[model samples]
Target chain A: MVMDLHVSLPRGLTLANPVIAASGTFGFGPEYSRYVDIGSLGAVSVKGVSPEPWLGNPPPRVWETPMGLLNSIGLQNPGMEVFVRDDLPFLREKGATVIVNIIGHTVDEYARVASRMQGEAGVAALEVNISCPNIKEGGMSFGHDPEQAYQVTRAVRQATDLPVMVKLSPNVTSPALIAQAVEQAGADMISAINTVVGLAIDVEHRRPALGGTTGGLSGPAIKPIALRVVYDVAQSVSIPIIGMGGIASAADVLEFLLAGASAVMVGTVTFQHPGRMQQIIAELPQVLSRGGFRGVSGAVGQALPAASRPQTRGGDL
Target chain B: MAGQQFHDGQVDARIVRREEVARDHVELILESPALARAVPGQFAHILTPGMLRRPVSFSRIEPDSGRVGLLFQVVGEGTAWLANCQEGERLDILGPLGHGFAPPDPSRPWCLVGGGVGIPPLYSAAAQWRESAPDVIIGARTREWVLMQKDFEQLGLGVRVTTDDGSWGQAGTVIGPLQEWLEGHADGQVFSCGPTPMLAAVASACRGRAAAQVALEQRMGCGIGACLACVVPARGQTQMEYRRVCTEGPVFLAEELIW
Candidate 1:
């Protein structure tokens, strides 16, 4: 059976499949190229790049938990100027659909990064990261408050013509309210559920395991929370949703799609099994067919309440 | 199909032998033709039952037999699981990774200083330089913990054993014998691996006397360079910057590290 995996986001952004390499985990692009065929991924969401180089946190940036990973990497990147000069051309040459995840210390920094990517070649979309729990300021802080979230999303939206995807944080009490706020502020799409704020203690050190003391938790442990957030946000907004959090298999992808994510991003698991995304992409059609869906679009929002099911747009097989 | 066999420097190797070298320490010999290229100071990232892969430096790499040996202590749940693994079981390994120690110049004198689990890679180096007969110092907490002394001696090299409680050859740390060795061979090159404090001490000892290279161990997420988790402070052009241990060097010149 022929299965349609095509995904169309707002502002003319299109993906060949529903599987994207999540930011931070996949690096810029070249890091995982040895393991994965870069051109075959649905989209490569490079790590969050800021306006200036970030040194990141001190030692012990990552701590492994049961079926999960806690990291406080602080969104280390070489800034927009270096990214455009070094990383972009490589991705373009590799035929990858690049989604640049942008972060900043302030609204202006986010805008500056977005504006910098305005005319860059092969940059398919901009994933505005207002939900990174690792940073001390302007990351999840903007995500927790609706007004701040709206301001950051609006700034990025006005900075460039590229499709703007606002990543949501699960730390907030009401993620749907923030989702609605960003939607009203003109975000073209939403990437639900960045990592959840969590902490792990090192008994031997008598302190936190991570150098930042606390970290953003991702992997299979947070999948349920991600699904809940995606479901709530999908019910609140009309924009397309890109779901990510502990996505390990095609079955998990279908779960996110059914909960209203038009596509899914895979991280963490790639560290354990670098070739997982390709396997998931190849297995998606069989999984989708067995679930009685002709294509990804049909699976999108199928698990949501009938009254709140998203009006998904795409060609069904 | 050939491409699939060795994707991302990963290989499927079966454990050919497993030996408990000492209390809480296990030595595993893995056979994988794909990993035959591993050298001393390089490491393998082995998948455990846990979330992350464990990075263990190669104690021996026999390219002719397609065997790589790993000597590690049971420090945590990850190593404990590795210690429990039996022979003949297949392991998912990513290896022959990171920069290894530079080959010793036959004309210059060299010494290998290692403490605790760190002796494995040094043993591999000694094996490679068997003809050169490099000086080897082995450090442990007690006599029971001393590892691979005979192995180093079998390579036609003199072995000096040091223990904290004077239960072994020397009364104190490896520093005493290392200093003595340095005094004799003023133009010697020192290669050391051990806990951070031991490495720091070695770096200090070799500061003005001999050049030293150290292999560091850090908590890593991705054994590859992507995660940026296993980083060490190093001297950059203008200032100190964190360099990735996995990509740049698990082995680095002593002077390059900030310490």
Candidate 2:
């Protein structure tokens, strides 16, 4: 029983599998190459890149919770120029399907990064990051407001012909509204959702554990919340959804697919087990077959309301 | 990239031995051939029941035996769980990761300074230098808290033990003995580990007197460089830059650190 795991998105982007390495968790490709085969992943979404270099937050950046991780890394990167010069060549050489996750302090900065990535070899798509909770300016702020989210998505859409994915934050009251706004503004896909905003206190120090004080919670703790957001956003938008939040196993991937995510990104669990993504990809087919599904497309949106389920595309067994 | 010869990968190492080294400090020996290439200050990212892997430096690495030792104090839920792990149980570990201490110049007099839970890597360093044993100083809050003293002495290295309550060999911190040692051997090199405050003081004491490299401890997400979580401020070209403690170092030159 051969189970097909391929996924196809808008703008001619097609993945060999539905498992992608989430942005920020997997560095700019080289870090995990020793532990994981970079080319085998469906796609490698590099860390969020800004127009200029970002130094990120201070010390004590990550704290462990029960089945969760809270981090405030603040989207630190070497800027677009260095990324295009140093990182892109490496990923291209590795035969990886690259998804550049773009971020900025303003709408122009997001577009500038998107435009810079234009015609870049091996880049399959652009994931617009408007939902990073760590940064003080222009991150989650744009994601919370539907108008700002639409504007950012529109700018990135104009800057590049590549498929654009607007990452949604779960920190808002209505992530569905934000998803609808981005879909209206020409977003080809929606990656729902980003980490949930949270905090941890150091009782000994009488202060917050993270350098950014508050961080985005990830890992098994946010799976249910992520499914809810992906399910909600799937119902609100016509574009496909890339689901992520504490995704640890192949079974979790199917759950996200059922909740309306066409593909899933694996993050925090990679820290605990670096080879988890590869393991998930290998295990996905077996899990999918066991769940009475022939392929990933068959499982996508299976749990959604009958009237709201989007038309399944790509490989269906 | 230089001096990093260890091939890092995930291994399910079976616990070969477990010993109570000190009060609340447990030393577990695991059969991990992958860590055979590990140098003095390199560490292993061990997965406990917790979400994040704990980065514990190598206390002992015996390549011939295919066994590595981890000496850690039971601090939180993670270490406490690690302490309860019995012999013969397998542990999921990723290592021997990170750059370690550079080989000390044999011509110059060198010393090993360690405090509290920071003595493990220094022990590994001392074992490597058993042929030409350097001066060793191990400090703790109390007499019972001092660790690996007999292990150093057993290796035929002279060990200096210090305690805060004056119940041990030297009263107060390792600074008093360290200052006297620096006065004696001004051209010496110092490799120190333990608490951040002790490292700061060691860095201060060695200024203009002896060269020093100190191992740092920080809460890490991914014990690899990807997460950018375990970072320490370092002197960069124009301004201070955050360096990953897991990759750039758990071991760094004292002068290179911002504080």
lDDT of 2 at B180: 91
In lDDT terms, which candidate is top?
2
Give the range where candidate 2 chain A is weakest over 10 consecutive residues by summed lDDT.
A308-317
- Residue-level lDDT of model 1, residues B1-259, one tens digit each, is 0123348588889999999999999999999877878778999998887888999999988889989899999999999999999999988888878888988887889999999999999999989777777889989999978888988878878899999999988889999999899889978899999989999999999998998989999999888888888888899888788898888889999999998
Candidate 1 local lDDT, A122-165, one digit each (tens): 99999999999989987779998999999999999898999999
Docking class of 2: medium
User: Every model's Cα RMSD, please?
Assistant: 2.1, 3.4
Error of 1 at A108 (Å): 1.3
Q: List iRMS (one decimal) for every candidate.
A: 2.7, 5.3
DockQ of each: 0.60, 0.54
A1-317: candidate 2 lDDT, tens digit per residue = 88788898898889999999999999999899988888999999999999999889998899888888899998988899999999999999998999999999999999999999999887889999999999889988999999999999999999999999999999999999999999899999999889899999999999998889999999899999999999898888888999999898888999999999999999988887788888888889989999988988888898999989766655443
Q: Judging by DockQ against the true structure, name the best candidate.
A: 1
Interface quality of candidate 2 as DockQ: 0.54
